[model samples]
Target: MVKDREQNSNKEKKLLVSLIWNFSTELKLILMALLVIFTLATLLPFIPSSFSLSASDFRFCISRLSSVNTTTTTPTKLSPENNTTTELVLDRVLDNGVIKRTFTGYGSAAYNFVSMSAYRGGVNTFAVIGLSSKPLHVYSHPSYRCEWVPLDPTHDPVSTTGSKILTDWGYGRIYTTVVVNCTFPSTTTPVGGNLILHATTGDPSLNLTDSIPVLTEPPNSVDLTLYTSSTKKKQYDYLYCGSSLYGNLSPQRVREWIAYHARFFGERSHFVLHDAGGIHGDVFEVLRPWIELGRVTVHDIRGQERFDGYYHNQFMVVNDCLHRYRFAAKWMFFFDVDEFMYVPEKETISSVMESLEEYSQFTIEQMPMSSKICYSGDGPARTYRNWGFEKMAYRDVKKVPRRDRKYAVQPSNVFATGVHMSQNLQGKTYHKAEGKIRYFHYHGSISQRREPCRHLFNDSRVVFENNPYVLDTTIRDVGLAVKTFEMRTIGNRLLRTRQ
Candidate 1:
């Protein structure tokens, strides 16, 4: 009887276990079905809606978020003042200082960009250059305060291959640049010569006649800076090489260039020699005296290795006398030696710039400038295959014709957008205004046009009709310019015709 009872109890326990197992399995299956439904719900946003989202929509969302953050948070005060030169602060973002250095004046406020590491390439050399409008007595000129040091013969590295030497100047300051090819290269044999030394901070004690020591070191890199007093504060000017290779201007040529620049700027402005490559030493030596006699100090800015092509055009500086003494100037012109973009007005560059400054909204300082496509004018200007570099040409401030080129100017577009022909602007739009300022771009002769004219060209904020104003001007002249006489409309229309 007892065994039979135990058997029955075991049978009951087995039955209960079977029931629990079946219940749990069914629950798991139901859960999995629910999970699938939930997943589909989660992915619903990705399914195409009646109105599709666009790339610009995403950008707009990001912009909105950024704007919100900006509006919600107040920027903390920086530990050190960057705008004003006071006591120096170490290990802080030189944001304002870097901005001041990169963009010199009024329109700089419109530049909405940031940079890190003021000299990522490296600023190892410092040099000081002095320029005198009137010839100064080398013995007594107050501007002769800087020193030119000779490359140390015994300490320099030795090599037998042609090499270049770079140096740094300045005790340690913001004005630093890289000077290239200042040292003698190592050849199969070492040649020694007396290298003339220039003094920094007026060291009368420097040995004036020390031969630059022969170096066996393969040419390395260097950086430099320059400093000078403002003797003629109203007549100060500085020349910076746009793409290096500025050592080629001859002395007589230098004088003539100075005279030309002086006439152009209405002050004593001239070109100052900096550093140069081996192929250009003859021109370098000719201009070295002006650098040595406290007239000009050459600065060598380090460039990236990528720019191994196009050594044809370089930049030289020109400005009113006040540019040197005061760090402010009316206009800063950057053009290649082969290219000159002349304004079509009798007003000084400063007056033109001021006109823009007074009229421009803080956000967009760059006024649209139309280029007067000058041809060689050797023959009937119209018959030529576009204008070559030699012909001085001008266009009516109304419209531009169509063009077919790899790169076309943008009609109604600022000169910075496209070149040769105008860009098409069918669906885009921009903010615009009719103001006091005007822009005229004189692209001399298409033959001398440089390649990759991207940075040199960019579209304006506004477009006309369904096409970009930078491409053609006919529509704008007929529609917009006639109504408002807005310079931008005319500018855009002229740019479009060239396209």
Candidate 2:
């Protein structure tokens, strides 16, 4: 038995040695190949540049895995949560120098990969990396206020073929100036003059050429322009309010919700605040500019209506008028200021609109909103370390009983007394989507000193329970009383009631 065990140990050692040898050999080969490729890339600057390639064709990768399909069983094809992010690190060795790095990564993920290069006279410095992906849409980042002007293909009217190019201006605070260069490719045609550029941020129809002059350069395939003013950068169309004002809510938590909500809606979407109780002035002051330009607008309605000073309601209203409000936008969602919506399969609000365009109205898919009830005081200063729902002053509101349900049927009312339900309905058909295809109800987590908001039921998919005194109650289904603040998280549904 001892001899056999010794033999087995020797065999394992041999296998391990062989595996190590093979791995080393593979690593050496990879390094050698990378070195050869780098040498060839170094010679690119000398190869008399070609001006025949179209701007679109200049983009390197469009692998077979990047296309959208309705026939495939997998609904989520390319979500940021599931896919690997392609990151490019830009390092600066000198105090005042620029670097430009150009390498291609897969683009089918929401945004396109970026190629950045820094320059100092004849010497090419370090190149940093960035993206123009779906989530990082429009090539703009908080680090730099980049601007893109997409070229229009329909300028000539008489000619069928046209070219497109996007210009970017780095953030103004850190970077003193922004430079734009339009270049024709080595594989396509000489695209010049007749190109049109438009800004899609605030006014999608706002043409930049009407306000400024577009200088036309040479046939060498490079046209250069620059923008120096930092304050004039483009911003999103909706207001983005910080949950920091929600008192106890952490900034990190708010960031997660923001990222999830932004991606779920459509990559470059913005948000605004509607603090009904008016406890947070800082959040409003910070997001003021977006409000002024209508790029991001807030609707503060604290004193708009008061219900015996016991409760107030806060909600967000998004006006997506830039994207053909009639077609691109089919319906409006009215959710509690705390609640958010997320759909499965990388499905965006625009994509869903396309799917529901066939039907006139539909029910939104519902997710139950929940959180640990705190036992401490109602103010933000209260700590939840020892507090638990069992010791709290308030109990989870219940659904009301049948009768006295007339107050629930008003069309203007968007939320039920309890948790509200939703369906992605078109005509009469209703079906359940995955939790990935869900909306979030985040009220429970954001309780302030005065209770920031009351429930609202504005979507077409909801109806109230059949009880009158049951206001602020929670019901998982229809035919119950309305209760106050029952459904705090996702997946809860409000039943319909008739007047």
Candidate 3:
């Protein structure tokens, strides 16, 4: 295993080198040099006898150098962002079932391949979660890495594309998280083939060293005419894809969340948790029981911190999670551990999900709750002693106009997704999911707190300056039942300590 890893590492290093040594960039430099010499010769006759280089003259040459394309290709293909990120653990599963593929850049653009799905009698499409916002040319053809051989000779490749910006505050000259919906002709079986995105001017087939491999679903997946009685595709009800867990996290809250969601989603639901750095001794201990039960999956993504992509590289992590478990689940939920997902009292979990199954994706509204504030009107603070969701039950009275809503998607339909919602999905998306379902956003509940009750209000109407207060103990009511469930399943010893 060690020897194989070494060989693969060596191969990756070679691929990185080949991407850096771009032919078109070198040619541009040579052409630039010729222009400089020609321009200098043309202006020589105008100078006086004792003509020498001046500061301004030198500045002109330096300006010329700036435009000249250098061999220092920071953008690359199928490579890590920088030297520090070389230690990132990538699952290079070249099987047809594999979901995500990432690339640095092939000179002009970078690509973070989330996954690809193919359909017969239509188009073959791939989702790139993060890439340069600038438009790109894709080698969607399965066999050719850079060659754009269309099934029909007249079909325009440039017209078929989709994109959505996932960045809030901008980073200078870096890769931005965006959705890409580029397609190719679908008929030939992909069989885990390779494809690349490039700005190749010459024959694209020549620059095949850094093509990223993709996982394509069978055409029969979406094609009705190709139905087979013997087809035994695995199916799941609900799957989770969470953001990177970092910083000091509240283990008490994490434990309750795991237990609650596990029960909330029932036996078949599987949660995929990414441990960027936060899942420490206590958090890991809390996750141990769920991990043992095979209900929770922990991916150690600590190395992804090297790339300062949006919010601890969370967009990349979630996109990876999506593609990684694309076909495995009927519906995939994306959110953070800090938030407790709650199905309202009126709605049953199965009925709510089933009702919304007709839509490709639905956004869950947030009931932003306070982490520090508590409702003393119910009783003294000592009376409530279950989980963070139980004790800290104060919610924001004033609703913010902005949409910080989380969402759930039928993975098979979505091409690319954001932290808040999904894009390029086949079916319509329901943006307003207020009464049907929503999540309680406990703002800073993930951080460890000694008391948590900073200001105990008498009634629900009492408002603070920025932190308006209102008592909504709905989840608090459910937290008690979850406590009982935890006591039975994970053991009372675990719950007793938290109490």
Candidate 4:
């Protein structure tokens, strides 16, 4: 009976020990599962919710978490104060390789349809578009096509060996050249097409598009030979400036402009004037001598209206001039009639060019001269005598850097041209002649029709009286010539009317 009792106690003790061991094993498994759940919760934010975590993914997450040094690092956060200065945040789409997020509020993305020309082979077309931002992709398609054709930097037989990429012009603007080949041949003078620009930023669903009404004909097909003279055939070492003149300008103002450039540039200068406005017979008569001498070539573009704004048409005229005299002239400048290229330090533009021989391209800073300095308390005559020759004596209301203003370039080096910048240069060396050369832009003095300059008055008291390159004799001579020409023209018109 005692042996049996001892045996029962031992059995009871063994059962108790087995039960405790099973409970402890179960508790350890439950704790391990809870620990795993906590780890997954911590890593949930980093991993995409749509992606299911496989064994490899879990391993990757574990390695990534292990590599992070949380103790030493601080979290990065974007705020308004550091938005402009901070590096832009970029995100890539998982399905499609597209940039979904980019720096915003920098500048608005915009583009203008410059011109389109038929390729030499006639199977392809060349299109030029001016943009305000760098676009991710550009597409061109015919009206009949349902799909958009991507434009690549393919070789262009017309402009250069390779298609011109987007060139930055500052102030949030760029210029891109695209080549579009027709899928099916159509017997049309100017092929109809549309250009779609996809920007690097913004809602991926939206894009900008412009119509290309006439792509077959080149923009320069206009009668460039209308004012060509025998003397123009000879290549000269001169700085030539071209401008597309629109609207009616005062006869005196016209003469003053022509004479000012003529006197300043001397014999080593030529002006190509595209008369988009109906210039008076008297003005033409005054310019007839210069026209015959090939010092000035005027093309009547009165009826040839292409673009909407006057500024848009100016780009076309600039491109036309660029192609027309690319080989004939050494250097070329594109700006408005009111603007003058002033080299304060050097005697002539050639001398300035000589100094900047190492650079293939140079931009001139624009100094906006106030109208108050243009005209004194007196009339236009006294204004010319006092401030006309002494333009540097006037105060500049605003000054724009060369990168933001008009430029001069070797015509051969530039593959494309813009109002304020040049694109696709052979050497691609652009130098800003900030202090050496200044573009003295005279506004509101003569052309009051311009809305922006209408309110500007001779009000500012600031003056640049210390400048030493005032051309008093040239101003007097040019002013006198203009007055004489006007007098003779009015007299002739009066005689004709009497007859």
lDDT of each: 0.29, 0.31, 0.66, 0.50
Alpha-carbon runs more than 4 Å astray in model 2: 1-259, 267-273, 285-295, 306-329, 373-436, 448-499
Q: 114-209 in candidate 1: lDDT tens per residue?
A: 110111011221111211111111232211111222344654433221111111122112221111112223221122212222212222432122
Candidate 3, 348-384: lDDT as tens digits? 7788998997899999988888887777755774645
TM-score of each: 0.25, 0.27, 0.63, 0.47
Writing each residue's lDDT as its tens digit, candidate 4 over 438-463 gives 76666644453221221212433533
Cα deviation at 194, candidate 1, in Å, is: 31
**Per-model C-alpha RMSD:** 24.2, 27.3, 22.1, 19.3
TM-score of 2: 0.27
Worst 10 residues of 4 by lDDT: 141-150
Q: Cα deviation of 120 in candidate 2 (Å)?
A: 58
Among the numbered candidates, top lDDT falls to 3
Ranking by lDDT: 3, 4, 2, 1
Question: Which regions of candidate 1 are displaced past 4 Å?
Answer: 1-241, 246-261, 268-331, 353-499
Winner by TM-score between candidate 3 and candidate 1: 3
